[model samples]
Target: MSVVLLALSASLLFLPGLVIGLAAGLRGWLLAAGAPVLTYGMTGVLGPLAPALGLRWSPWVLLGGTALFALALAVIRGRLAEPERVWTRSKHLVVAGSVTLAAGVGVGLLFFASKGFSAIPQFWDAIFHGNAVRFIADSGDSAPSGLNVIAQPAAQNYFYPNGYHLLVATVHQFGAGTVVQALNAMNALLIGVFALSMTALLRTLRVRAAIVAVAAVLCCAFTGFPYDLLTWGPLYPYATGVALLPAALALVVRALDAPRPALVAVTALALVGLTAIHPSVSIAAAVFGLGLLAQRWLTARRVPPGELLTLALLAAGALALGIAHVLGTLSAAGGPAYDWAVQRGVPEALGRLVFFTRSFDEPQWWLILPFVIGVLAFRRLLPLLWLLVASLGFGLLSVGAAAYEGPWVALLTAPWWNDEWRLAALYLLAVVPVTALGLVTVLDLVRRPLPRRIGLVAAALSVLLFGYLSNGLYHQRNGNRLAITFGGGPTVTELEQQAMNHLAGLVRPGEIVFNDAQDGSPWMWALTGVRPAFGHALAGTEGDGLGKERPLLRERFHAYDTDPEVRAAAKALGVRFVFIGQGFVTGSQKRAPGLVELDKVRSLRVVYQNPDAKIYQLTEPDGQRPADQPGKTPPGGPVVVSSSPVKPKPTSSTPS
Candidate 1:
């Protein structure tokens, strides 16, 4: 039943591609293969356009947009004529087999790993992404601007693309079950996209059918990405973005090779979609495009002027539309929030490439060893070698604060290569195909005496060995090693959910609730619809000309139970309640002064209490301040009140 719902949601997501594919006369798997890229691109384009027209993003809006886009294509082409696609029976079987393998492994793993997603995210950023999805679903506001409204109204997460969250919100809006189910379904769809996109791209590159099937399976087999990331930081957005990237690039490559107006249009949309999904993908696309162009020029000895002109025009249009968001992202780079002091040397960066010393679940060197050999074996793959060099160069440069870390270098690596792990996804994009080719190369060497099935079996065994040797074949769950575990990470406790439900009924919509960091307030907003006063994402709240207000609010939250001034500040900030969950006093701040003061404060009346958490109400009847006690002043006396408002710097979106 869950699988059926997931399939329907995936079909809805593929609607845009279906229309585009029909209009383009694409046949077979290629017809819907371009869906992920087109949807991503259109979603990004729509986000900025939606709010401007006074309409929030919705499934109906996307449907209408896709309809209009298809209509435009039909009008341009003057008819709906299907293009001829010639293929042999064996080729057809191979394509079918590739898709089946991808769907089985991709969707199967996603379904298993995300079983508990319906409740709460067990990872860190799940809080932010989940809440963002709910915000869009509830408010119908999918605008790229004003996204971080949980902290400051003016804040936007332009640094991170909103396409993934936008897609998830759309799924939740139309799906039968909870937001978690929608998210889980979307994750499954993305995995399918990741695998099929690679298969489609391999087909475009004219790789053999048998190899394509192996590549599709390998896409899901890699434990480093599309799997490990599911638990570690729960990098859902990045995962989705990377999945769509190959499809976008494939469309561009095909378009450039054969310059039809429709193909160019699709290519432009694909690039925009890549950018909308994640800036890193867009960067990788540029590198791939340039490498392909260089390879083409070297081989053909001439440039396709028509194709180049079309690409230039499309790029100009996309840039004009997204320049503000682009500029904002650039300015926010290297801000204190994204800076890391740890020095990662070349050896460590290389370790990151092989997933060595990265995590207990990191991939082994064997998985990538064949990919390296394949690149070296084929002269035609030299351009790919250049692409790999460019990717690795930027990745290495991203780790240190050398002369290369200046603005010039940052312009190339910001938001994508800012972390080495991110580049791993891009590396896999190339490595998957190389690995496939390498396996095929090995099979060719033994074809004289060995049977074809035996070679296929050997390829499968090699991948299994890679997983086993990496220690990723099994995962730690409940302090025990388990095989075939659906996903990694802890599930949300029932006690926490019950407490949140109780608190949700007491607090009015959009009410401010001061919550302890250790209590997981950062991620609870999606479930409760109550705004958090402070969390890791909302660190300083020192932006929008109200910077000084954050400190005042923070000080008030800690001393609200005792200081009249603190209570006054709370009223000014519109804070109504304080939630102290079980883990509130267990961290580094267990002995902090604020924790001590909060424990002893007498004014807070307990509104709700359980083994898991306690909620305290700070309001009184008639909204009058309590009379100041004569001895209420501590040894340092009353805090001085300032008359002027302090301007706060906007919070940075760089990952901590």
Candidate 2:
């Protein structure tokens, strides 16, 4: 039942965009592939605007806004006629086959990787993402401009893209399920969108339908993309943007090919969607668009004036936006710049790229053979060659040459934080299609001399062989990685979750729980109805107002019995309970004395306890006990006996 509701909610991600695309005269594969990109644009625009218009962000508002905008587009275009039949029967089959294969492999891997819909990705960014969804749902504000309110209640404005969160929050608001479930459902939908968008791009490029189908299967085979981002930073918004890039590039191709007003408008809408989701990907798309334009200009005997104008305007807009985004002129917080140290020498980095590996994943040396074959087979194709070169160059620069510290490199790669994983994913976006084409070339050569039925069987066997050689689309390894990340002990265990569930009954409404966020206590708010003082693990120290009351509380809240300052801070913060989990989150284990020794605090009475977790209610600072649970413990005395006793349970599980 939960999965059913989640599926239904996930389908909502397509409606607004589909309506807009249909009204704008998008047909067949274009309509199917373009809807998700338009959906992100609609949500990204409306999320911030809804609050200003004195309206709450909801699915209805999204649909209504899409309707109004789409109607305006229809009126301007002056057409609502019957859709044309642009796709052939083979095209339809290709679409179906591609979507099924991509979704089956992509969503199937994700399902097992997550363990279930309710399990959260135990990574750093996931902490912010999960809490951000709750913040939007609870505060009724989906604007990224004010997202920092999740961590700091008094934050005025902080800029972070919230398209992914808005989409997930919309599903959550629909009563689909928990935030984690909604997130998982949306992730599954994005995987399908990635496949659909890539199909659209390949079709626009006039690739063979067989190659398109092969490309769909290969999309899930690459571990660098949609899967790596899911595990690494769990960079959901960036992944969302990356998923939509192919479709946006497809629109760019269409507009460049014809320069029709409607096509250009749709392409602009796609870019807006990309920028809203993650501006870095929009920059990447711009880079590709520029290459396409350059190739056109360099080859054309006489470029049309209209085409020239269209291309120039696009280039100018992209340049201006890229400059603004990199300069941080678009937001108050400014653009992100990271000084990640070079982890590998140039030789090692280049070697990793040559082997189709990124970060620490196993190398896929087989990809090189197909890529080389495709390049040799289609060496005359300038656009394909350009894309191959440009993507590989960017990959090399991001991974190998990042230590250069040049201004040009910094300006270009700053939007991505100069991260190697992100650039590697972008690199795979171009290489995968070429590799698929190469595979098609190989199958075609083998099929030319054989009987039709035998040829078909041989192709099927070859694909299966490829899958086997690639470790079953790399699912086992990626799934194991995800399982370890999601499993208990690294972050929160079943015992800890149960204890939090039990505290849901004890923690009253309008009360804040002081939590050792390092111990995964920040998830208390996400798992239970009770609010935590810190919404994320780093909320206590990372935000503004360091060396203030919040940081003091974070470090010395357990000394409330002996420290008047701690007591005052806790009282002012309205911290009624303290939640302690088993240990710190993975890769973030540090002994926080104030949070660890809560049992010694006389003012804290253990209200709920489990082997791996405990919840304590703050007693009055004075000697008097609360009327509900009368205890005879004086202030600054030894710990008061609790009604619930803690018990020891043996366990061998270790944090990953």
Candidate 3:
């Protein structure tokens, strides 16, 4: 199933790209670069259109839709002018193949470093991210109104971005692996796409082939910036969004140079794709697109209406589709959800100009001096320079320094950019290109006769140093050493996993489970399609201005079983089972007192128990117990049973 999905997804990416390339008359490497753009553009369109057309939003649907569209494109291309020499010569294939192979190696190494693909990413975000994909895939609805099916205060459905979930869910449905595995596969493909896109972006900028290769090496070799997002996030959507930026920008640059209608459409579509994955990147795209459009108009003394119209349409469409997410974010814009203390002052921030966080394994100190020198040497690369400065500025602002904190802080860094770790990704987007360009510029200096040998030596040394800095072998080698770690570490132990599986088998789908807020409750929906009372509050699904779910969530943890509010909230939420264990406690379990009181409540019965966990069935507070269970105990101490591994039969129909 994984192989079929890989092949189908590859075709979806390449076939559309091939058709678009042929129609646009792209040559050599440009053709290869254009495919990813086309693939993303098509998926962006498919995400919104699938729900509208009454189609299920699974990988099969996505594959069918993309394949059909690609076929249509091929038919159209056949009627167009005789195709240009796409291969041009065998060397083009070699160059393209080699770049692809190199990218494959990078992705493969990262995959193993992260550990063999599983259904859940070991990152904290995976609790919600994995569940969101499961929700969209199972529900067949990616509409903003249809999200928040698992957590309380369902309004968050409008807040979280659906693009990454939509893509992954669609792929998971067609793929043979679990949702997490599908996500990993997509990540690998996008990483490769990003590498190819970077090469294409340099090529579009008219950088020499040798220089482009150097830049490609610099871009792909860095484990700190972009690859760090993989381990750090495992930020699935944001990572995908950043990966597409280079491709979108490359197309934009091409459009600026020639202003063809096809180029304009392609650029617009690519930008939309970026919006789907991460709005921050989309925001960046808007700024760059407008800036470039303005520059071209200034140079020509007139606007290219075709390009202008395309940009306007894209801007308008994105605003329309994302209005819910934007409005939801703005409504809650008092401050960040968590405290992000100032980590450093100006000096430290400046030091971070070259130093990266999270890539503890590889430190690229050797490239800093050359990078600064290259920046001065390549003054013509103004766009990348400006982007680098802007990205760095945002990173500094995220630190929440006293001098940097004011009305502007909230206004500027709300929702997405508030976290410095997230802002690091933007830094990568700007810095990778600048570093590559700088290194290439420095390398070009020694191409003279007397200095050629010195230049060769310098290049070799630079490669060696950068290679050491960019390598992830050390991290990969020690991957399983940690007992419990964060950011793609082993979050769940074997005992916990067995417990969760046991609980899932006992509970029916769509039934609410009154579990601890801090533990595996967050992942119940993702794991078994069952709803939990609450997860970690800082994780932000409950206790908000969104809806009534927060109050119910609170009652679940703090209210006594005999409390009318508890019963009412449980009834309203349709909770049938209460699960308890150390898995429910992380940091501190605020409801430990309530849990104690629950044991005394006569209306509850212990149905299942293990050394690490227990499951309880809730009898109706009004004396109407489930028909399957005998009324052996009155309104006294709750009947407690210690049993071996056992499975409970299904109960009456419960609304999901």
Q: Which stretches of model 1 miss by more than 4 angstroms?
A: 78-86, 154-160, 320-337, 355-357, 361-366, 380-389, 394-412, 450-492, 535-548, 561-565, 583-597, 620-656
- Residues 61-109, candidate 2: write the lDDT tens digits: 7878888878876775654323433567876786678777877777676
Worst 10 residues of 3 by lDDT: 647-656
Give me the runs in candidate 3 sitting further than 4 Å from their true place: 1-31, 67-98, 156-159, 231-234, 294-339, 358-363, 380-403, 441-491, 535-550, 556-560, 581-602, 609-612, 620-656
**Model 3 Cα lDDT, one tens digit per residue, 187-254:** 65765677677777766665555545655555555454456666554566777776667667777776
Q: What lDDT is obtained when candidate 1 is compared to the true structure?
A: 0.60
The C-alpha lDDT values of all candidates are 0.60, 0.71, 0.57
At residue 175, candidate 1 shows an lDDT of 51
Question: What residue pairs clash in candidate 3, if any at all?
Answer: 17-35, 59-170
**Candidate 2 TM-score, true structure as reference:** 0.88
* lDDT string, candidate 1, 114-156, tens digits: 5533535454456667777877888998776546564454343
Q: Which stretches of candidate 2 lie over 4 Å from their true place?
A: 79-88, 301-304, 311-329, 332-336, 359-361, 401-411, 451-454, 539-547, 622-656
- Native-to-model Cα distance after best TM-score fit, residue 7 in candidate 3, in Å: 5.0
